[model samples]
Target: MDAKVMNQILEIAFEKRVSDVHFEVDNPPFFRGRGQLIRSKLPKLKPEDTEFIAKTILEANKRQLDPSLREQDASYSLPNGGRFRVSIFRQKGVIGIVMRVIPPHIGSFEELNLPVVLSEIVKAPNGLILVTGPTGNGKSTTLASMLRYLNENYSYNIITIEDPIEFLFTSSKSCIIQREVGIDTEGFGAALKAALRMDPDVIMVGEMRDPETIDACIKAAETGHLVFSTLHTQSASSTINRLIGNFPPEVQEVMRQRLADMLVAIVSLRLVKDKSGENIIPVVEVMRSTTTIQACIRDGRLDEIEKHIENGVAQYGMQTLDQHLIQLCQQKIIAVDEAKRITRSMDLERKLMFTS
Candidate 1:
């Protein structure tokens, strides 16, 4: 109910490796780990308790809670420097809060169990790199790792436009500047436009939320700046369609050409419980741009993109979701049923029948 109790709750979450913590008016705080939400044994929260917790978060960020404010996005830090991406919203006329844990240190591809192909994907000198997935699937963390790789290896100027700025990066070989949406800049679109003029060699936009931001990303890539952003799509094909679909019908052709020219890679993520049923690992679908794939996008052959991606596994380090899931099952890292539950392929089970 008080600030110390709230901090204690977050500290406990950090110690337990919880991914998210939820607070609501009539329920005990819930902690999500390994894709399961477990209700705590603590007493259910009251209206004033939730409100006070929300107020404490707002004040920590030097902001006041407005009476008419129905939603808020912010970040909170513990005395030990643990960070959380905080979301506060009104539900049924009462306040509810959810805090997603941001890892204190960025993990490498091996540490996160991400495909080493991601190390290769981020090697592109200049183009758009998109990491797409449904929410809570570790999109942000993957991007952070890529940036970490760049920071340690390259001496480029990097700027990030984030909604609340999740990970705190200290420049290594590269000089880094991070801008938060409301506190540092107006929005993603405006910040992206300004990033282009700041002599940046690499720019990381937190998310492509609208047409203006998406267009800015494409243009930034076209002009030889490495761009990184995230989307909520499930696969490479849908990620392309969603980008081109954001524009008007008359201008979509132009948008497709721009995207085809600027795309470097698309990495889609799905988190499933590993064989031990104790840890979560990413099943990645990687689509690296090639001549054939670019032509498919340029000529509106979206359906054919997946086949090309699957076929490029040997040559270009590309793989479809089904391919990764099958590999996971083959290695006994994940169960076949777990793969089937997350896969979109119709014949995946049949293919697994042969392989498993």
Candidate 2:
């Protein structure tokens, strides 16, 4: 398809509020909505169609797809102001694209159906707050909601370092300075280092993608800035291990200590279809770093972390994934089978039975 046709397809996707759109050679466009990938009945795309589509996206960002380049990350804004996070890649030796729709406006915690505990979690004056999940599971949306909350209620300086930034925010009660990784700065590490000197009360790094970025995030938190970032992990315990595991074995202990000191909370999310089978809802596992939990991390007792998360539910707004999945099942928000499918624990059925 040509640029006009591609834009028309995007306009249709935007109107329908699809989560993502896929364009690939030899296949009709596919749209993902409510956790389902539905193929459009339009004609299948040819190689030139996808190449032209990719070229349109790259040119919009003032970029060109080099012959040797295999993939790219970019953002696009529609004529109506809708935005998308675009991932352009090569598949089967032909250009393929996936565009994730970014809602024109950021939703509030309540509006997004996030747990009320997030309001309490974001109150921490300084420390690292991580929102972890597999890709496409609302981590960015959750972070954006938290920042929107801070922007409306608190008068502070907030700096965001992003790769092709999504969800534009206007200055409200807070002064927000958003720096894109390639356009406004060299990278996350450099931007984060500069952020510390910019007098920011809160800093949001789009993703902790590397050792330097991760280290910078922790240092920012340790120095009393509220930092937010994401990881492609499923749980709090795993998130900790992933961070520490990134370092050499000799220095893992030091990394663990740093994380224990600066980590404020871990909000893990999984989206599942609601009971109605038409909409998707998030099952959240929130682990606030209490003294006991901090000790678990510092002492390398990763196995005990989930138990403490389960125990801290009532007092500290903490909950394990299974616990929240059980709650969702109990409340009839999601089917029992869906809960069972999402939780990795062997005893999920047993726990649901006993808890119910």
Clashes of 2: 0
lDDT of 1 by residue, 1-356 (tens): 88889999999999899999999999999999888999999899999999999999989888898878799999999999999999999999999999999999899989999888888888899999999999999899999999999999999999999988999999999999999998899999999989988999999999999999999999899999999999999999999999999999999999999999999999999999988999999999999999999999999999999999989999998889999999988899999889989988778879988866
lDDT of 2 by residue, 115-161 (tens): 89999999899999999999999999999999999999999899999
| TM-score, structure 1 vs. true | 0.98
Error (Å) of candidate 1 at residue 122 is 1.2
Candidate number of the best TM-score: 1
At residue 199, give the lDDT of candidate 1. 97
Error of 1 at 90 (Å): 0.7
Residue 170 of model 1: what lDDT? Answer: 98
